[model samples]
Target: MLVTGGTGGLGGAVTAAFIEAGWRTVVPVRKKTSAESRSGAVGRGPGSNRDPKATPAEGDAVYVSADLTDPASVDAAVAVAAGEPAAPLRAVVNLVGGYAASGLVHETPIEDFERMLSLNLRPTYLVTHAALPHLLAAGGAVVCVSSRAAVAPFAGAAGYVTAKAAVVAFANAVAVEYRQRGVRCNTVLPSVIDTPANREAQPDADHSRWVAPADIAKVIHFLCGDESAPTTGATIPVYGRA
Candidate 1:
């Protein structure tokens, strides 16, 4: 399994869920933080970590330094994930994205819009493109994390809305292209995720309705498992009453 952005708040929960489920998950992180100094598997690339001192915790996933935006780096991380013959790369969860509310469309700069597109879509495309071969080798699944805003658009975030909608479209396209090839792809549309950053950003808002990271993680875990074998090209909304 390859989980991009497995170092962030929601990503940590996703990684933990996969580990708890006994999958030898592979994580592509920008930098190996102190918490991940003991990364198990190491891959070779421009920004990849090859230090031998790294090791996996009891049931932790393999952490590889990678720049998801870079094709070579993404390929390196996928290689590490598919390295183990016993546990072939069977799943890929693309959670690498950001949300920014600069202003209305007229108030946002072209650079800001392009940056949102690059940040949200580029990594997902690169990682999935690099891992397709391995996923095709054996039956596998791909889960992309979009947002409720993609469907229920809000004010002041045109770039974010467009990028997330693009993600859903991309996932659906992958699903259609690979349906007969034993590769399933789906998208999870989460409402405002309950994370520390979101809480801090909307300190006065009602946090109770926000979806928990663990809750979403469980949904993602289920999507990649055998139970969802019949599911594909689906956009499952994970809005927690928000």
Candidate 2:
């Protein structure tokens, strides 16, 4: 399994669940995005990216350091995931995402707009392209992490809504292109995931109403597993009331 942004709350739960299920996992991360890494919120080292912290105590796990926005780093991470001597990557879950520039498009800087696109969209494009050869070899699955924001705009995040909207459509496009080849593609659209960013971004909101990482991870595990074989080109929303 290959999970991008795999050290954060949702990513960590997905990684842990897959490990429990006996699937070796490779998590890619970009540690330098900020001083307080999202991975730290889940009790993992930052800047180590996906360096395989201290060797997994149980099922296999490795960290591949890569900045998805950089084509070279993205390619390197892809190489690391597929080059594994094991059965090769059977699934890829893109969990890398961010919300930037909470303003009208005209007010947001062009750079912030591009950054959001890189964070939410480009990783899906680059990593999926990189992993295709191996996933095709394994005849496996491709899953993109999207948001309910794609369908309904939040009060102040026009950029986030736009980026996720693209992801929703892009995942479907990928599914359409690959479904005939025995490969499956899908998107997990969660609403108000209880992450540090969401908490900070909406301080006054009732966080208890949001979906938890474990809850979303369960859906991801199901999508990657065999039972979801008949599924493709679908967006499964796992949003809580928020």
Candidate 3:
């Protein structure tokens, strides 16, 4: 399993869930230092040590340095993840995305709109494009993350809403293109994920209704597993209580 953004709050939970389920997880990080630091974050559960230089001597999870937005870098990262012939790459969870709240369409800068698209969509397209051949050969699964705002939009975040909606559309396209080849693609839409960063961002919000990272991770893991073999092009909403 190759989990992009596996070092982040939600991605870390996803990586840890896969590892706990006995999958050899490979995470792509942009920097060697970030990879080294994330080694401890994803290998274990949330709130684990985050030492900038801590390196696990041996573990089921390994981090490879690669810029996900670049095709060459994504290809190299995929090669490293699919290194062993015995254990080919079987799953790709694209969690390499971001959220930005900007003004209305007229008030937002063109650069901000482009950045939103680049940040939320480019890495997913690049990584999935580069990994399709291997996934086709292995009959694997592809999972992407989209936001609830995509379907149920609010004011003042036009760029984020549009970008997230594009993600879902891209995943649906992949599902249609590869369903016969045994490559399943699906998107998960989350609503206000309950992470430390989010809590800090919205200090007074009712976090009890927010979804947990671990919960979403479990959903992603299920989508990648054999139980969901018949499920493809499904946009599953993982809004916990919210």
Candidate 4:
């Protein structure tokens, strides 16, 4: 299994879940130091104070340095993950995306709109495009993260809304094109994930209603398991009462 954005809060949870489930998890980080730190600290909370150099538990995780937005970098990451003789690549979880709140559609610049698309969709497309052949060879599964804003849009984030919606569409397209080939693709929509970053961003908002990273990670892990083999092109909502 390969997880992009695995150094992040949610991604850390997902990577740990897969590793716990006995999958040889490979996480791609942008910097070597980031990868090194993450390899030793999978699933640690944002507030963790553990020594960064401490050795991780056996079979904790493997980290590779790659930029998802770069095609060559993505390919290199995939190659490293797939090269594992005992556990060839069988799953890809795309958590590499960003959120940007802009003015209303009329006030938003074209560049901002394009930037949103590039930020959210380009890495997804590039990584998936490069991994398709490996996934096809192994009959694998894919899980992508899309925002609730894609379907339940609010004001002042036209670019973000549009780009996230496009992500769902792209996942559906992949599902349709690869279903017969034993490859499944699905998207999970989350709303206000309860991460430290989010709490810092919305200090006054009620955190009780926000979804937890562990909760979403479990859902994603299930999607990649055999029980969900019958599921594909599904847009499952992971919103937590908000």
Candidate 5:
């Protein structure tokens, strides 16, 4: 498995969930870290934001260093996951995106607009492209983290919304094109996934009602597993108190 953006809040939770579920996850991280042992430190770091109202998974997790945006880094990681022919990659979960500028198109500079698209959209396409051969061979799955902002209009975030919308649409189209090859694809449109970034942005909001990363991880794991074989080209909404 190839998990992009494994250093973040949701990515860590997703890693834990997959490990607990016995799915050997290969997180393509960017930077190096000293905190390596998740089997012992499991649920220690960011589980502080766990959902009080939701059930959580249990298990250990592993990590690998790889950058998503850089093509060489992407290629190197994907090669290890799928091209190796040793540890075949049966799934790819794209969690590489983040919120962009929250301003009107005119107010948001071209650099910011392009940066948002670069940050949110390109990683998915590049990683997906690199992993296509392995996906085709293993009949793997791809789960993209889109947002409600992609479909439902949000104020002062035209660039962000448009980029996310493209991601959702891309997943659907990829799902259709690759379905015949036994590969599945789906998009998760999360309303407010509880993460450090979100908490920092909306400090006063009732985070108790916010959706946990593990919750999204469970949904993503399902989408990548055997149960969702017939669930390709679909968009799942994961709204919390919205």
Candidate 6:
């Protein structure tokens, strides 16, 4: 599994779910941490030319440095994920995105709208584009994270809604292009994910109505695994009563 945005709130849960399910996960991080950062962490199979990092402790997924928005960087990250024959890249979970609320479409600047589009979709496209060949070879799955607002739009976030809807559309395109060849693509629409950042952003809102990251993670894990082999081009709503 190659999980982009594995260090974020929902992404942390998604990454953990894959690791717990026994997948050899590869996570792309933009920067290195003192404890977790090391070169060639993803493809350390014996006799490999890549430098070997220290053996990761149990349950630790490999981390490779990458700037998700850059095509060259994304390709490098995908290379790391696909380098090991022992752990062929079988799944890709796209969680690298952000939410921005800058008034209505009329009030928002064109630059802001473009920024939202770039932030939400660029990384997803770049990573998926780079990994599609490996996924085709391995007969795997892709789970993209969209949002409920994509379908049910709210005020002050036209750009976000459009970008998220585009993510769903992109996933569907991938599903259509690859299903016969054995790669399945699906999108999960989450509503107000109950992460710390969200809680802090909307403290007065009823957090109980928000979906938990862990719950969404389970759905993503299932979508990428064999259990959802019959599912593709599906838009699953994890609204959690919100």
Top model number, lDDT: 1
True-structure lDDT of candidate 4: 0.86
Q: What clash pairs does model 2 have?
A: 50-63
lDDT of 1 by residue, 1-242 (tens): 99988878899899889877777778887875555544333432222342322333333567788999999988998999998887899999999999888899999999999999999999999999999999999889999999998999999999999999999999999999999999999999999899999999899989999899999999999999999999999999998978
TM-scores vs. true structure, each candidate: 0.91, 0.85, 0.90, 0.90, 0.86, 0.90
Off by over 4 Å in 6: 34-59
Off by over 4 Å in 1: 38-59
Give Cα distance to truth, residue 72, candidate 3, Å: 0.6
Q: On a 0 to 1 TM-score scale, where does candidate 3 land against the true structure?
A: 0.90
TM-score pick, better of 4 and 5: 4
Q: RMSDs, each prediction?
A: 4.3, 5.1, 5.0, 4.9, 6.2, 3.8
For candidate 3, lDDT tens digit of each residue in 96-149?
888787788899998998888999999999989988999998899999999999
Winning candidate number (TM-score): 1
Candidate 5 RMSD to the correct structure: 6.2
What is candidate 4's lDDT per residue for 16-102, written digit by digit as tens? 788667777788887664445554554322222433334335335677778888899999988987886767788999999898877
| lDDT to native, each model | 0.88, 0.79, 0.86, 0.86, 0.78, 0.86
- List candidate 4 stretches off by more than 4 Å: 34-59
What TM-score quantifies how close candidate 2 is to the native fold?
0.85
Residues 148-192, candidate 6, lDDT per residue (tens digit)?
988999999888999999999999999999999999999999998
Which residue pairs of candidate 4 clash? Answer: none
Question: Which residue pairs collide, candidate 5?
Answer: 29-66
